[model samples]
Target chain A: MGETPPRSANAGTGGIRVAPGHGQPAGASARVAEAPVSTRTPGGGDLGGGGGLPRARAFGAERAFRGLTLAAGTAVLVIIAAIAVFLIAKAVPALRANTANFWTYEGWSPNDTAPEFGIGTLAFGTVLSSALALLIAVPVALGIALYLSHYAPRRLGTALGFLIDLLAAVPSVVFGLWGRDIFVNPVRDFSVWLNTYFGWIPIFGGDGPFGKSIMLGSLVLAIMVLPIITSLSREVFLQTPTANEEAALALGATRWEMIRTAVLPYGRPGIIAAVMLGLGRALGETIALAMTLGITFGISFNLIENGGNTIAANIANAFGEANDTGRGALIASGLVLFTITLIVNITARAIIYRRREFTESAA
Target chain B: MAKRVDASNVTAYYGAFKAIENINLTVEPKTVTALIGPSGCGKSTFLRSINRMHEVLPGARVEGDLTIDGQNIYDRDVDVTAVRRMIGMVFQRPNPFPTMSIYENVVAGLRLNGVRKKSILDEAAENSLRSANLWDEVKGRLGKPGAGLSGGQQQRLCIARTIAVEPQVVLMDEPCSALDPISTLAIEDLMFQLKDKFTIIIVTHNMQQAARVSDRTAFFSIEKTGDPGRLIEYDNTQKIFSNPSHKKTEDYITGRFG
Candidate 1:
């Protein structure tokens, strides 16, 4: 079997010689001789060739599976790189054509001859609105999450969890329409009430016409982001180890005390990640803000006044009638938004990574 | 300070399934009592019921009287947290809080009891660690995460945490099953020392372990599968091992049958 010359000769003549010897006990020997010859020829062998053919086929399949998964992983990176390159290529010409400093100027008029525009006010509005939204949403979301994970009966918790997931699936345009129509009157009255009693504070000190303002936009954004944060944090809280909870109880902790000691500490990183994800959604939200905000073009800390704008809402509002420079400017603003989201995600990842040593060893 | 444990006509259940039936035992203060049994025999269940820890699971409950120093723990008006505080438990698996430092782990019980002064916390942490026989190995690394320790050290840290509040009783549920031989020996030695200050009740599958460490041994077994476990024999460890009165106890100790 080890001689190459004899094997080659046998491969050519063995099939023909084995075909006529089926009548005697020598038939078994003849079939074995033909089997090795046929199996050695790769794809030409039948599955009846047994061990070697199936094993070789399985090896080929394993290699093909690995290659497919590798390609899938690389596709995501390729798409991200392509987007960044295209955004930069389109943004450079718009920046070069502008007569005003892109970072400091407060007005936006990219359709004019000089195309003087800047993102200073837009960036400010975007950050302030999202931060305010987070302030309103985070506490409520954590309360709901804790109730769902630890306090509610199992059936009710499951039902409430499903309802929260459904909330996340609602269209943003519907939220915009609802905020502009039904929610605006109550918010206007509340703003008037605030300005009456506590107008000394900068954010609450607006003069008049408090119906469409930054506060309204932030409230709408908070409503939109609440379900996402609640669901994700609930998942994290539910994953607290039973052993750790038992340890706390055996140490004489009350129910709330057990949660404070065991559940909250274990869910810290997850809560941070969930909050950052909600912040990302709030920052990039457009239709809801466009409908709810006054869409002014200046930097002001008055949250209850009728004037605010963000990078994404500006892009959506201006992109309809924009010329070449205007479109490029909008794309440039999109690139800035993209960069902000990227920074937020990377910071969240760094926070998680810094604590991996503790979490992993415990696992 | 140690407290005597008295159980009369105690039975436990998980929803509709009876786990242990009609157990009666008295454990003297400052003595080690070992509960030996086969798998699914409800020895651990009985031990958890002593501290009212069994009811933490949904639908799990116990019936009859379990008393500590003549006060019934199962009385309708008794506070469960106070019961657990007076009777501490160490689990089979060593579960030190993964998020806390070694010093924080030791002081966790005290913190739960609302001890806020830093000097008091520091003193309790040191004393508990020393009593658990872990201070010498961990004194230099009090700031390190509790999970960074070896398995045996983590178990000892859990012991220290349990004792920090000065509980009158301590329960161990196969505390050395997940440990190596050397760690097992160290825990056994610590148990001998701990018997001076706290009432200790332990559940074990290892017969030799029960014989070696316990003052009194209770043998638990079941009639058949799906039946509740019963106390087959209760005697001094020497009498139970050397000359058992019941045939089933003799058979289990000699390794003839579970």
Candidate 2:
């Protein structure tokens, strides 16, 4: 505390981000790093440098914590990156041999010796069915969320919420099995009824899968993802500020009105995130659609008639028997699916981030 | 007097536990009535009963007649929504709807009641804002979300929202406790002006505040002898503070006991 130190020791020890000589620590910013780590008594003969042990222990503890976090986070990132890399390496030859037209031209011949593979049909089926699934899931999911958060009594809400979360945690294979045996069989009549009554719409207008079509696949996918979307949306709706809710009710608004003004407003970002989570689930849905969709590799716009295959469903159905180019092309499809999911997840996060900022500034 | 709220022999309970017993009060139109008491004296609880706001709590039941202008609010034929529509309320903390803009926050009641006319909404919103004395500060930022406003502004915004519905009576529960001195003064002024247009019933811990703002004050005390809470005094502001009819009231105002 008595002696003055040299400039370099002062600057470096001060923990300034820049190394410009003679520059001091920001007046209020006061670098606590420079403060001695010792709690030595004032007259304890220069404290015997006791600061070293605790400083080292604290540093070690902090470094260990940060190291563990960074390692865990990076491991996850690297694993995903590795998977993408593997998919790209496997698919590059197929993509190089074919052009963007590979995505547009409708032909599947990965099994043949000189077979040309095109994802045109698969891409169309995937996008169309996913879009349809979103259309079906968003409104129902939001409705369930609203009911769970605002309409239901406390005990009932807790029970129903638990059930929804349990449904979400059920294995995808089990959902597929359920779809094949129970849900699809029962709902087949409804699909046929739709085709009969309102088949004028191109989606429902088809030659009839006898209840096995792209529409059926979309529906199965939608049902499978319903709990996921609903659960996430419910949490977001529940997180709506209590004051915000009461404000609406005190204004003579109905329960539904309070939800519209407060619950939905606070939950917009979460709802978008919920839909994306459902979309991710839909993109990867394979066994359920395969069992129910009557999978065939053909391009058709009529959703009620012929079965359409998603990227995941196509891979599952054909990956075992596929040959060299066929395997490569299938892996290529996997790559495209991976890219699409990444785009969806990243976009969802970006939306949530922007929404947080928007609400923060507004608040 | 154009009485806005009349509660006769009104008693409320939660399950087997009686919360407030034998409350008789009349709130006149264009006048302020204060409910002052120590904690758990049913001051806030009684205030909420007037607007049926306390009914939102589960297992809360009322055992006496409550009316606005002689219309029984709890009658089987009465619509709860219509009853609440006539009596607006502000809470302990400023509770502006977080997601809505200030404009939307004020006009939410009108919108929900199917008032789709934007011009009418605009005019009402402006009038309410002016009545709450928040118009000049928040006028240009009606499109901005309400939660962004400061605590005092948010409280004022809530008052504005209450005014927008044009209710017959406005019930406030510790409306200025969360505010600063300046904010509290602003609200006191707002309340003074608001009494000209609507009946006001306020629950406050500040006896000085009660003395300043209220024309009539109901002094309440909790009796430890029974499990249920009892209302010890109900009188004019002057009598309650200057020459209270009850010992508990004297003890409370003279700083002898809570």
Candidate 3:
């Protein structure tokens, strides 16, 4: 009864750290970090009652170890926090002074010779492009995960899974280059034909000769983010309880039925989390959007006729070319992207928390 | 209560590792047959094979014939789904579905098998819980999640779920191992009542548990000579404990070897 499952490696070795068990009242499993050698009593496991040179040395080593580990972890956390704060500080003045022109005024010519700046188009473009990307990606990504986990043969699934992971790890800039070279040009040719056939439709009419529309930019974005969503979904689906899967199989349910009844319900929390994580990536994405999107400034809702600019792309496009006001405005745009990502992350965690309650109730 | 299971030359394997080999026995119906052994001794694997659960692991292969009533369970044309439905199992850990209500967990199999009417599901769910002796404890919270139950309650609920499927045989792999003494006794007592309607094959590490709940016992040993596991003796529970014919069985029961 006393031999509980050992605390995982991260919790440090055996001074009785708590295992994360179901419904363990918080603080009941509080770990007792080992006492310093000088603090140890004569009756303790280690006999250091005399407390001399060796014991002092041992205590010093313990403090040093903990200090170094904590320092490394804190450093990483601070770096991320610093980046977020810096983005916010630099963008605040511009954000506060952002006139209606900041979001609604379309003419964004940041030249050294003449004064000009506005983001009405960029704000709309960022949200619309990312949303369109998600529309193209989430369902297909979920399907690939389901097929690999439950339907495919073992070897094929394993091999294909590795390939997906490799693709996910590839650099975003690499994907941008590849997307432009392989997909954008060819799709530009095809988009013109599409616009010709469907040009009468408002959604597909009137812009560029070759048709480098928002749809093309979104499609390329979808391709770039596909592997991340698919891999995460696969991991979440795989984490569904082994018992639930077996219990379903024992009930005479078909493979598809079991996934519907058991796997999907269990994976819902993780799937939502995965989508939010992908959205964060999409929000921060710059180079890929810059390349695939034709860098147009007009706010056309039409998906197939005109390319548009996003907040991230506008920052990248303007920062290198402009003077003071343009840099401030670009910094402000970066701030907006950062705030959206933070809100998305916080909301995702909240949703996951609510899901945990639902899961516990259902179980 | 007594029940019988007829397995002839049954062998189960995971790739080159033969998990269980050539286990043949006739377990009388409505009786509890305990399979006792040490860890990795194939008792759990043997219990799983009866319900076709061994196939869950990748590269797992079962050979020879397993039959409950002269119908070879391993026959080439046998429907694996059907075999599993007919033979339900409870695992060592209490694993009630984490996303179903307490009532739903009990009726899960019935609902999934396309039995939709609320009346039918309600009847099945209530009846199974009653049979598992869990109805009173869980009746008040039928709408609550199965995961909300205590460890023992959850185990009983799993039994109730297995009961709902109306399997001809019930196979349990160390069902009480994760529980405390009170919980263990609760399940052991439930197993006794359950045997009146189903053939039960339980694999246990505790020798005293085998003596308490089982009517008959089959002692399975690890496959000797790097082969795999095979049943060393199949006999009445008393005889296996008091006067086993096989030397290995005698040693194991006497605590000389597990």
Candidate 4:
């Protein structure tokens, strides 16, 4: 019998060869001959493998599994690095050809002979619109999340949570179309009402032609991000330990007070992560902003004005008529958007990490 | 500051399933009363009902009469928060708020009741920690997270937090079940001191623990699986342990049956 040789061979074979008589002609003989030998070895003896169990082979399977998973884990970093390299490579040429200061010039004319464009207005618009959207969405999202997780009956919470998740699944294109054809009118009227009354507030102080303005764009963005924040926050809230909540209740806390003391603090990191995820969604949204926003280009704090444009919206609006230099300029803006999101994500992670000691001790 | 707790024909249920049926016990002010029973025997359930904490679960409820110092806690208009405030509880597992510092956790109950003065909170925190026998160990690190303490110390911190609000009655649900023997001894000693200021009700699986610390003992048992728990005997700790009248209580105390 090929006993000793098979033991060494089986070390890397992950026990598949030990399936009695599957494909190997010597399978039964190999098993019978290896039983006594396996019981003498340290690893096999631990499993009491005198009955011809494939102990060495099983050990090999675990190592093989770990190697496979390691590769899968590394693939994500590799792919992200590849994307950053591609973006930088494509963006440099158009940046050199530009006749304007890329960081400070507010106007974009990449298609002209001496292409002149800057990220300044686009960057400001992106940050302003997304910040406004978050301001409008976070409180409402948190309210809905708290209601779903703590206040509603279990069955009702499940059903309503499912509906909110469905809203998240609705395609961005559909949200864009709804903003253009259905939701824009009410937003326009509301914008006019704000201008009529609170015009002193610079954000709400734009004149007529306010239908397709930054206000409309941001409101649409707010609606788009609301479900994302709500669902994520609800999950985090639901995970708050029942023990902590009970401790609060036992200490004479009202229901809301229990939430304030137990649920909110425990879920703070998770909530911040959710908000960042929503912000990421708001920042990257393109078709929705393109369709909803008035496509004028200048920095203005008057949100109801028809003159705000974000990087993503610019890329969508410009890509169609773009020359090679024009394409590079759009990709360059995309790189900037990517960097911004990267910074937002890193900051969120840092906040979560700083609180790791408390969370870990909690577990 | 202690107040008497009276439960008459109190029945608790989880949705349609009855947990404990018609439990009647009176705990005297400033005394340590212990509930002893086997697993699934409703000792913890009965303990929770005393502070109205039983109803915190989604489908859990209590019926019949329960009173604290002649006030019916189950009255329709009685504020549940006030009931809990008057009757504080310590759970089986130590649950110091993970996000709060030691000082903050001790004053959490006070803060909830709208106490914002730092001097008041500091005094309360120090006083409560001292009473719990934890001040000497934790005084230097009051700013540290409460969860950073050892298991025994965390349990003590939880005790401090519970009593910081100066509740009249304190309910402890197997407070030492998770601790080592030394930690258990420390908490048991704290229970003796705590009985001087608050009415304390404790539930324990360790028969010896009930004998050692309780002024009075109540035994709970169920006939079989799925049956609601019933009180078999309640008497002075010495009488219950040495000369229990009920056969079931004797059998349980003597290790004949669970």
Best by lDDT: 1
Q: What's the lDDT for all of these models? A: 0.91, 0.79, 0.79, 0.90
Look at candidate 2 and give me any clashing residue pairs.
A363-B148
Residue-level lDDT of model 2, residues A216-264, one tens digit each, is 6887788878998999999988888777777677777677777787788
Greater-TM-score candidate between 1 and 2: 1
Give per-residue CA lDDT, model 4, range A161-234, as digits (tens): 99998988888889889988888889888888999999988878866778788888889899899999999999
Badly placed stretches (over 4 Å) of model 4 are: A1-78
TM-score of chain B alone in model 1: 0.99
lDDT of 3 by residue, A182-209 (tens): 8777778877877789888877777565
Interface RMSD (Å) of candidate 2: 5.8
* Candidate 2 docking class: acceptable
Output the TM-score of candidate 4: 0.90
Tens digits of per-residue lDDT, candidate 4, B106-182, equal: 99999999999989999999999999999999999998899989889999999999999999999999999999999
* Candidate 1 off by > 4 Å: A1-59
iRMS of each prediction: 6.9, 5.8, 2.9, 7.2
